[model samples]
Target: MNQASSTTTSGSAAGMHPREFVAFIAALMAVNALGVDLMLPALADMGAQLGVATANHRQWIITAYMLGFGSGQLVYGPLADRFGRKPILLATLAGFVAASVFAAGSQTFAALLGARVLQGLMSASTRVLAVAIVRDRFHGRQMARTLSVAQMIFFLVPIMAPTLGQLLLNTLGPWRFIFYALAAFAAFVLAWSSLRLVETLAIERRGSLSIAALGSAYRLTLTNRFSAGYAIAAAMTFGGIIAFVSSAQQIFVEEFGMGDRFTYLFAACAFAMGVASFANSRLVERLGTRLISQAAVLALIALSVGHIAVILLGVESLVSYMLFQALSMTCIGLCGSNFGAMAMEPVGHIAGTASSIQGFITSVGAVIVGSLIGQSYNGTTLPLAIGYLGIGIAVLGVVLVVEEGRLFHARQAP
Candidate 1:
């Protein structure tokens, strides 16, 4: 019930209760995932209506948004520092709603892609500001716990969003209405944020835009050998996930002939990620981040190799594909957080800038890798399988260079 807007309280963030603050932050994080996952089931319908014929070309719907999202990450943190969080956040949320509406009304594929990019550019604020807001409220273990809880909520979106989009497509009988649903969700968030949020950055603490300083921080982030290696490795690890998502619709619906059941199977594949994340959380403290993540990478390489062998031997089936997909996804889930944490470990002082830059790297870099793999789809899962193997090897190569030919060492993460 407290309405006071002070950022000094230890128990509550500003004036809102702790639960509300966490939920609000989690909701912000969820919007980014929802933006991506909610459109998966509708991509086919959108492509047909927009006259996009090639199955791979339809992935541009997802790729365009990701490109914008990746590009936007570099600016939002610095902008938030200079302009204060609330104003910039409110503006971006409004932009998100408007862009969503624009997308909903698009008559051509190009126009829809442009709108989706704009929507993604606006939605980028949700990820930047959500973490920034959490940092403003808590530190150390509390901060970690808050992020963990928010991420738990964020992970749920991928599991359920495809099914939600399928239902919308079924009832609304058009894919554009999915954009309308997205717009409505953004509007609700905008209202909730406008009504309840307060400025977290203090006037004295507000930073001026300094290109030299920003560049220096970026330089420092990239120059740290171990951190840089982990950052790139993490991005490569994420690339596999992006590739899977980009091609999931085509593989499930068209190639596998799953039809309406695509969402259910897709959801099952996504579920493996959540389970792996849970297992990682319980095991990381004892096993160490490097060891577990390295193991996962090895598993990815092994799974991919085995998958390709099966395909070559003419033993591939929908069940085999799903099994391999789920196992690979589980590896990615295990790698995602551990690799990121390790990458950030050496850059604690410049965590914000490092996060922004690393986020850009992961997203844009993954998009590049995913686009290549997705475009290589040839009525078989071989390309995706190869993509996963490549990712695993690339990660291992980077880790070797950074660790001096080491794997699963007990030494502390840099």
Candidate 2:
């Protein structure tokens, strides 16, 4: 889902060029993000509809997916590396669509949770394949540019997701319809992919797949402080954002009374993220990955402290809070792309395993903690603000550990 080769495979959409192919690949990867984003607005509604009273339980829908998504990648990436990207992708898409349909028909909380887990498992294939494909075809600035373009397109999900969710909620009924819509979307993408997607992994380039092979990649990635540190930093930073994401709808709609309008603010932040992502795409090549990512992390830490201070000072206004959050998200946009590339840069041969390891640690492992922090949302911004504060310090610590350098005076940043 990341890259389509003009030379290796059957070129683009018959007559389309390489750029178009990359865009299509990005779209495929971005759909997984959409699946996560589109569900935010509907979380509380779904929870209550499913007889889930405790706020914490509602997060299982998301956490379970991430867990499955993280763990599933371990197998998918290695298998794709050994086999071909196209076949693996189609199988995952088919599974994802089936899971989504089952999810739509879920009559119990457990049933829905299971479906979401399956959904995550299936979608993990797309994510790793996308990154690997990108790695296969492009490197450095070209990869960054492709990711930015894809992210720019992907940003539309946050912009449109809530409205779409709201429409389905009101027009069709409860949350099941949302899953139905997702199933339909998956079907559409799977169909399109079946005809258009290509295998980017060259046959000669295919590596042997064994537990030992994965172990070797894992050991190298984990021992290399530079890659390990940045990867962990990326995970912690993303953990902070996921903290908000896993809870924002419940806090705004259920606690603050925003209702379906919750999506608008979410979209607003997402749009800012898009702006910053596009800006990063342009500047990353010029400034280099380390500097951009470091700067963004600095901005995030600064804002996190500022946000907590403002809230604790008794000046609790929703407008001011949202403003700061949107600003932080802009920083998030600036940071996330580069962090991923930086973390995965060193592990070239086992890109799939590297990707899986990266995904598991940051998204899978960290999101669990993030979701718990979100579940601690207690009718105020305090918990959310405090969560950011903790995550900020944690991410900085990871940066320090990864670099094995001083905090304010680390000579070698990356």
Candidate 3:
């Protein structure tokens, strides 16, 4: 291994401790969340400012970003594997910053949508390379624990981003300033990464930049039963979460009548997710990913079914809805990192390509599912509830297939 790669694999990068390493990568990954969540508060204002007529058309902003994000991952994964993590990350961060600036200055809906797409394209590197970097340093249950910790930190962004965006929209007097703030934040992250982040992919381990090599790497990632099955299961679960995110503002503000309190309520649910992730980080080594994830999925399915029943029976108070949503978010937190770690466990040799393909599948699937769920809003929570239950059951089926009908069988932790 090269000196830079060796340093990262030694457990610290650029003299940073493990906790700081986790925080750094978490911040990078949170960029994607911020790009999506922070805009929720400003969506109405942005749509108005950009001359959008239909309420549902505003969702195209998010869908466009997701489409670009998913497609861009395919390009970055092989490049990261061919080049190095740090360089690819730095380059993408720079592009992300530029795209944010363009988005801030966009005068039309079309221009803004284009900018969002470019921003998502650049942000894809943060997701792909961060996972690749983690895989470079850890494997198996250790990777799961590390990812849980990172996700725990990442949930903080979603918890506060809407509130921050709302404050900016109210105080700054325009929605464009939110994009400007994103640009500034990206610039800061870029500077921090450039100064501190070290290369994780060793030169000797770098894949070739040939089409044949890329094709083989992708084939290896897709053909592995464990990896493919877990990836699909993860994608389905993620679809449920994305659907909630996309519809959250409408559900909380319009259906439940939370109005201005929506941000706090959303943050509260996100805090539940954060707490779950932290607990998963602590317990994954002992309980194993399969047991924890399977239990969580089953719980999610039950919660979704019960919530839907409550809605149908006319007992769906705001309190009850929040309660169910919080528990569901917690379940998602438990499943997410575990599924990711299990999917990547057997595919570590092609970590970048594997991470890319997995992310592409999950992001695209989530976007389509989320769009369908979000657009189905009829001033009621039934669509979201049904989405959750349906996706959760699908995820469970995929997991069962991955484990060959086994649900909670514990394997030795690596």
Candidate 4:
């Protein structure tokens, strides 16, 4: 399909106005974040009630969901490519609603985890479809800017979800209500998307669902240097994010004694990310995605070093932790959309499968990386800091190789 109208146009070239399109896609993407965050405050309680013996094992709740989310992307991408984006998205959202209800009613920890995995498996479509649809409608700097804006909006969920979840737990009885809330919100998104989201994948652009066609699309995506490299780099960065999330309750509530303040602290960090995303949206087209994201990666490495120094100096206080965490998240915000846009830039012809493969790699790889850091949590921030530092160095190396030792060179429009 022809590129959506120029980035200068009022509405997206994808048929929806910019405001509506970003909001819709953001809401869709937020579904995944909401499913994750809304359970944070309740992890301890859920573990206690479900007879989970070890604190570290409670993280399995998050890990299981992530695994399902990652693997499900591999399936949705090819199906969406064959069937179309809208239908697949709607079906997945419907499944997400059912899964939420199933989770809410679980009588055992194993059953609850099973339901969460199913919920994540279904919600994976939102990530795949949102990226694929944007690829269908935009490219290059336009794509980067659009994703930044959507990320800005999507971060709202992370900022509010923990608080919302905590509120429900305090006022609405037990942790089960959190799952019900997830169901309610997802149902609304399902209804809204069903009504407003136009199909960006033109019928002529739809790919075959045959195994050979699927393999070829995935192969092309993996073989493309920019696509594969940026995806891996992004995955490294995401590992830091998931590590923070998987161990957040322990770090804030158990280690720092934040109590009810944990959600607010989390919200502060998320708000910082949201602010950075908005800044990236405005600046990416002007400064270039490579220049901005590369700078952010370097900044993350520096911050990680400082963070580790503070931890080792025995000066690790809540205030210091909050400042460091928020700043680190700011760097992540700057990097994420740009990295994704760069990866998708070279593979628009197979946007669905490409999005799927990349999403799977980033999600699964991040879970592995995050799991290592999370499981190593020992009532300290040292592990998390080291994770960020390692990820930053790895990402920088990959970017250097991908760009052939070049850095910050902007791409002209095709």
TM-score of each: 0.90, 0.91, 0.96, 0.96
lDDT of each: 0.80, 0.75, 0.87, 0.90
Per-residue lDDT tens digits for candidate 1, residues 42-137, read 887788889998878999999899898888878787777677778888999999999999999999999999998998899988877776666666
The digit string of per-residue lDDT tens for model 2 on 373-398 reads 87788877888777766766777677
Pairs that clash in candidate 4: 4-13, 5-13
- In model 4, how large is the Cα lDDT of residue 35? 87
Model 3: per-residue lDDT, tens digit, 145-234? 989999999999999999999999889978888888888888888998888887777687899979899888888788887788778888
Model 3 Cα shift for residue 313 (angstroms): 0.3
Clashing pairs in 2: 1-130, 2-130
**Clashing residue pairs in candidate 3, if any?**
none
RMSD of each: 3.9, 3.4, 2.2, 2.0
**How do the residues 1-414 of candidate 4 rate in per-residue lDDT, one tens digit apiece?**
235443233133356676888898999999999988999999999999999999999999998999989989998989888999989999999999999999999999999999989998999999999999888777888889989999999999889999999999999979999999999999999998877777777676789988899889988899889999889998888888899899999999989999779999999998988999999999998999999999999999999999999999999999999999999999988989999999998888898999999999999998999999999999998999898899889999999999988887875323
Which stretches of candidate 3 lie above 4 Å from their native place?
1-14, 411-414
- TM-score, cand. 2 vs. native: 0.91
By the TM-score metric, which is better: model 1 or model 2? 2
In terms of lDDT, the poorest run of 10 residues in model 4 is 1-10
Clashes of each: 0, 2, 0, 2
* Candidate 1 vs candidate 3, TM-score winner: 3
Model 3 alpha-carbon miss at residue 170, Å: 2.2
